[model samples]
Target: MTDQPAAESTTTITLHLWLDVVCPWCYIAKRRVQAAIGLFERPHDVTLVTRSWELHPDLQPGTGGPVDHDARVPGESVAPGEQRVRIEEAAVDHEIRFEWARAVRANTFDAHRLCALALELGGPALQSAMVERCFAAHFTEGLALDDHDVLQRISAEAGLDERRVAAVLASDDYAANVRADEEAGRRLGATRVPFLVANRTASASDLQSVEDYLGVLREVVTESA
Candidate 1:
């Protein structure tokens, strides 16, 4: 028989990111990862899944003070203040604004639940919009994340159905999903937010630049081939 042509490649790389909505570094990491994906040759073949990991699950819903930059970060050696400064300086290149002065340390369970609902309702694209909106609501606008009204507005802005969002927020819908994501992160040896896993094999925790993230993505792609 005559030789047949090679079949087209259909490999898809799934990038799982476990992040907290209120964590500034998570926000930076998200932006950098997005930028890296954009620069990838086969961006369309990549799937980004945002997973929940609450930084302060025990803190009461409505009881958080101003951003405490001096607090110790779980995975990093530098103080949060210095980290924030470094992130802020780097974020300028990404056109991301960090309103550090206005940020608050709030419990993110409800927000994480909302993200889970987004994923359930509309898959990765919708979930990504919901995530970006939530991050901007907290980090840029300084909105109160613990407030249902604020979340409702943010959800509506993210293009999620208002009634569905209301139903999810009204009840404890998707709480289990949020918890499961955190459990998965813990099993993966994550002690902090922005724990990134590529194709369930390679992983990275300290991504300093867009190039760093791009390198990880390329490595995974090469290994898959």
Candidate 2:
């Protein structure tokens, strides 16, 4: 029998990001991932896919109103004040303007639906812009994500058609998509927001440094090559 040559392999890496819009750490993680990508040798070889993971899916909008500060902790007994301080320190270091004291508690299901719509109609860039706007609205502006007006404005800013956004908001357009993403995250054993899956192999949930992300990317690139 004749010997055959090995097939050529592609070096592109896919990063699956599971995040919740209302999760402060997810926002910081997004920034860290961007910084790490910036430092990668072949940044263009990476494809980022942001998936939905709601922190408070059952919380209704405009029901109990915004919390004075974020109260959810990751198996830690830190007081609210100390948590704010710790998060503020990290936010300042990343140049992210965070007003946790003024932040509002919101159900992010609608916002996630908008993101799914953006990804379907516009693509990843629009979806990314939509997610960014959602995070900024919740974490920085203290806007209620479940409010249709707030979502409309944010979606419009992200280049989505205002009327289409309104239609989707009125109906349960992408609820299944959001649920599917959450299901996938659960299947992958993600119990927290900002869970990152690199090249569908390595996964991390705890907040890590940009260098950590870079290391993961480099290892994936080397393995693929």
| Candidate maximizing lDDT | 1
Q: Positional deviation of 28 in candidate 1, in angstroms? A: 0.7
Candidate 2 residues 32-138, lDDT tens each? 88888888777787777799998777787777465655465554677656777766766666778887656788888899999999999888778889999998888
TM-scores of the candidates are: 0.90, 0.89
Ten residues in a row with the worst lDDT in model 2? Answer: 1-10
Cα-based lDDT at residue 80, candidate 2: 59
The list of candidate 2 runs beyond 4 A from truth reads 1-10, 68-80
Question: How far off is residue 154 in model 1, in Å?
Answer: 0.6
Model 2 TM-score on a 0 to 1 scale: 0.89
Question: 94-188 in candidate 1: lDDT tens per residue?
Answer: 77787878888788899999999999889999999999998898888888788899999999999889999899888988999998999998898
